[model samples]
Target chain A: MNLIKLAWRNIIHDPLTLFLNIILLTLGIGLINFILLLNTQLKDKFEKNLADIHMVVGAKGSPLQMILNSMYHIDAPTGNISIQEAKPFLREKHPLIDKSVPLSMGDSHKGYRIIGTDHTILEFYNAEIHAGELWNNLYDVTIGAEVAKALDLKLGSQFKSSHGFTDDVDLEHDHGTLTVVGVLKPTGSVIDQLILVSTESVWAVHDHDHEAHDHEGHEHGDHDHEEHENGHAHNDNEEHDHAHDHEGHDQHEHDHSHDDHEHDHEHDHSDPNHHHYGEIAPRRKVNDLSREHLLSQTEKDITSVLVRFKSKTNFQALNMPRNINENTDLQAASPAYEINRLYDMMGTGTKALQLLALLIAIVSAISIFVSLLNSLKRRKYELSLLRVMGGKPAKLLSLILLEGLILSLLGFFIGMIVSHLCMSAMGDSLYERYNYPFKAWIAHGKEGLLFTGTILLGLTAALLPAIMAYKTDIHSNLSEG
Target chain B: MLSTKNLSHSYKGTQAFNFPDLLCQPSETLLVIGQSGVGKSTLLHILAGILIPTKGEVLINDTSLYKQKTNALDTFRGQNIGMIFQKPHFVQAVSAVENLFLAQTMANKAKDTKRVHTLLDQLNISNRATAKTYQMSQGEQQRLSIARALVNNPKLILADEPTSALDDSNCNEVIQLLKHQAEAVNAALVIVTHDSRLKDIFPNQLELN
Candidate 1:
């Protein structure tokens, strides 16, 4: 029989001690590998979604929360700042700023955030439209890859928006269901989970909510809804006629949806804004999203403005947050700075877990050494019998060493499977909570070092026992037996 | 043939031994009897090529065992010598057939399953070939041990206290098996033990004081 087969036989025959050794080793390696997977993926995803944007300008509060809300979309916004105040940064070519995209949120569908961003977000994330075209009109929606897969949305699929970002079904907006005009390919960023539309869509939903306060009488509002469906009205005149229909009390239902049955889908209009852009009746002039719309709405606000500088060395880079924090009511947070702080705060817990895993590994090494040494004592006569026949001293030594090596390699593979299985078991709940998809198996180069280290550990543990086997007193052991 | 001349041994912390010269022709069995303090194991170790004597040489077929380098001497021992212990020690994790396989491979011989099975059948323990050594009764273990020793077709076979752990009936059965296997392989056999029951069985005997 070969030395390896002989060694394997020896290991399996003494199951209790070797089994304990393998269990400790599996737990040790499993925890270490699990931590590495979590750390790498968390760092990769956080860094990838940064997308080279330098500063986030929003209402002043916790700077970290502003960066998280604006860049990562994981937290409630600090507050909203006027769109007029962020206009200087959003201009086509400001001197210090490379580009800026304004974000307005506070609406969702089934826990996935619906963000009102224009084409700049698609350009910023380098996302391609996978199935259909980008939103051509105000309320038309372009869905992210993950959002489409999760919600089973498709081109021409329609769904109603909820008022807030949380997934409470009770807060569903009863006005109009948003239409999916496009789907974006997977970008491996936060954009993969968002439902994107023009900024006016968010304002229109809230502006309609605000118009319900101006309802004249419930009976008259119900009357206007019936006449709108019964009357043949053009898209431009429906809003003017819905003026009388707009004064609803408890039930602010208007049948403007019926007036848009003849709406066209062509995006070839020279005028950037379309008829349905302000197709809802305006209780006030601020709802006029026509030409010069943004200029006239001085009271309108956006949640945050994402700013990338023209150059890293711009004096603005050194002075931007400080300047904004001291002089303006708006807060400007650097994504890189805030994210590093987040990692440092998380590193303490990861370090403690890693230390525990290392301790388990050390204990496992001791157990392996003790187990091998114990087996060597019991197998002394057998080793001597080998020498009595034709075995060299080196062969006996290698046989002992091979047993330890074999057990350790087996434990390492089992530990790797354990780690991946654990990750997969935690995957669905983690995705439900944070919306980051974690796969069960992701291989990297670091495992190669782990393999070499395991071999070294096994050999080191077996060294003393193997030497004893090498030096076995053949005559004395055989005679003693 | 197996022979040893001037086979004496001594070391720093152990008693010195000056052994009688020994010679056994092919198909012959020799017995060396001794008390517990008479260095019976020492003589077996020197003759088995495991120990380099203070001053002596062991020969098998006219090739001096100790005259070769240490590694070559090991290969020579594997090719020429087989050993059996009194209590029938084995690599207990492996099967009886595998132990026989180990004997052949360790002795630098080609694997011969037919030779192994033939040796097992000759010992009349062929049914226990696939059983682990620990699973066998003491009598069956002793027979398997003999099968292992003869599997390599060695030039010299040494049995250390082979009948010391056996009853009178078992002792006679084992000694007969040893002599028959040695005659079958045409190798010289030597049995060293303090057991008096073996006195009448082997006629060529040496008693150490």
Candidate 2:
């Protein structure tokens, strides 16, 4: 009834050509949508990874690599430093330094990267233990959501340490089992793939191995003594000494047995006597393998310390770690700076893709122009007839303009659906690799702008065709025919 | 109701027409006869306010048509004039009633479905009102165009070789239809043609050189 309706009817009259034009326009819009979605998802992942800690302190290497390792857990660490060496800076009670969580990573239990950290890491990272309580002692471990799910581990289940960071090991440790006490809720972070335990647990494993070596040395000495006595026809004292050696070896074998005979003996003896026992009475504690001996055992060290600031402070507190690194032999990195640098390096590719989308949109606009201009020639007689029947030039021009607008809007709608489906397909891989929660229907500010811009471009493309329609010499055209 | 005085026009700097004086009173049919390329269509275009004369003026109801703005002149033409082309040039995608409705919008008036149906009935094209222009026969399309033109109740009706393709019987029927419709609205009817068969249908004739 109106010019716009008439224009739409005319476009639909030739469905094949209109469909082709719609496809072209849809491709242009779809490309733009895909780029926008990718850019948004990547930026969101980066920001989420940077949410907790303000700075990272470690042994010096590439700053970007340090960020990728500590924040995202995707790259190799910058080696470890002695915690004693880091103690002096930690004691400097700066007003800006809110809290610090030391990180020691090297060991893994069943392919999950084990992170030795303090209890403050949970609060600092806003992590909630979904099912069980947090680990309070050595050898008790808490695993992240994906870790639990992948290994089918539950609270109270004990799993042995595998050889490497990945689950492709041919070697497994004997009796080096860790108890899972908690499983963390899914935060869509690097923590979701990590296994967390207290720093004391890391030291206990090494200490336990050292004690086993000492027991083996004692057994060897007893065997040598018994062998020396067996070679001689002995006096009564010598006979008694050989008997003592045999008893001692027997006791050693009994103490080192894997059965619960010793535990049953202890439990029966301690039940009635516990009330009379004093707090200071010497009782065997877990992993109390003498701190002096434990420190002298091996040279495993910490990887980094993630420092959270109290508020929006300056980079002054950041310089403390840098000074320590410069004056001594350690490394410090500002995650914010490294992330910005990384974005700058990757932004060029994003910019290139955006430019390509823009160029394609322009070409699409020109295609629309050509299509409408061509239609003008074919519809000349119809245009002249309208002119004689009191159709104004403005109405004729608006009709063509409306046709272009309809094409662009339809293309935009189809493009959105296409982009959403594409994102949904990539969502699993994206979350796995980068820990990004990419929802299909997430809206970006630039998306609205892009659609509006396409509509405007379409209107602009129609301008020339509208002018041609307006300037149609109805009298000359009619008279000639 | 319509007159042209000392009308002359040129195309590409060559004089194509020179008409001293022409007039058409209300309720009268005037036929313009000429050979091929003798500017009969050009004269009709000028009289319909579609083309401007190089030297002379066209007045409709004592007002100069050339002095009005382009849009205003279009509106005035839509409300006061009707035209039928040699071949019916209906909007190919739309039905006949829709074409008539589009004419109402062009005249900046609200839709008058009653007027459209009445015009279709009078033209005997009521049965084909819902048919698309491409779907209709040539005669049906011609009649639809005539209905579209008269839907706005204009004061002048201009026909440019409207019956050239019709048989003798159909030609007379078309001529009589235009005459009857023009007289019904008290409109001045002007027909431009090279066909000599319509010479006896109109009492007043202008032979173009």
Q: Second chain only: TM-score per model?
A: 0.96, 0.96
| Model 2 Cα lDDT, one tens digit per residue, B121-141 | 998989988888788887777
lDDT of 1 by residue, A1-481 (tens): 8789889999998889878999999998888888888888878778889988988898899999999888888777788776566666566667888777888887788888888766777767889999998865656789999999988999989887776666777677655468898999999998999999766666565544433422443323334344434453433334543442222210121222222211121111111122222125322222333313442333456788888888857886758878988988889989999999999988999999999998998788888889989888899888887776678889988998898799789878988999999999998776655557776799745798788878788888888999999998876776677
The TM-score measured for candidate 1 stands at: 0.88
**Model 2 agreement with the true structure over A1-481: per-residue lDDT tens digits:** 8877898888888788788777777778888898888888787767876866777877778878878777777566777665555554343365777777667665566556777776667766577899886766456789889888877989998876543344445433332467888999988666777888765454334322222223334323344344434432222322332232222322222233221211111111101111110001011123332223222322335577787776646667756656766787777777888889988988998888878878888888888888888888888878877776677888888888998898888878897888888888988766545544577788866887988988998889889998889888998788667
Worst 10 residues of 1 chain A by lDDT: A261-270
Global lDDT scores for all candidate models = 0.77, 0.71
Over 4 Å off, model 1: A163-168, A207-296, B13-15
TM-score of each: 0.88, 0.75
Model 2 ranges off by over 4 Å: A52-54, A57-63, A75-98, A104-116, A126-303, A308-332, B62-64, B122-124
Native-referenced TM-scores of chain A, all candidate models: 0.82, 0.70
DockQ values, each candidate: 0.70, 0.58
Q: For candidate 2, what is the DockQ-based docking class?
A: medium
Q: What DockQ results for candidate 1?
A: 0.70
In model 2, the Cα lDDT at residue A230 comes to: 47
Cα RMSD, each candidate: 6.8, 10.4
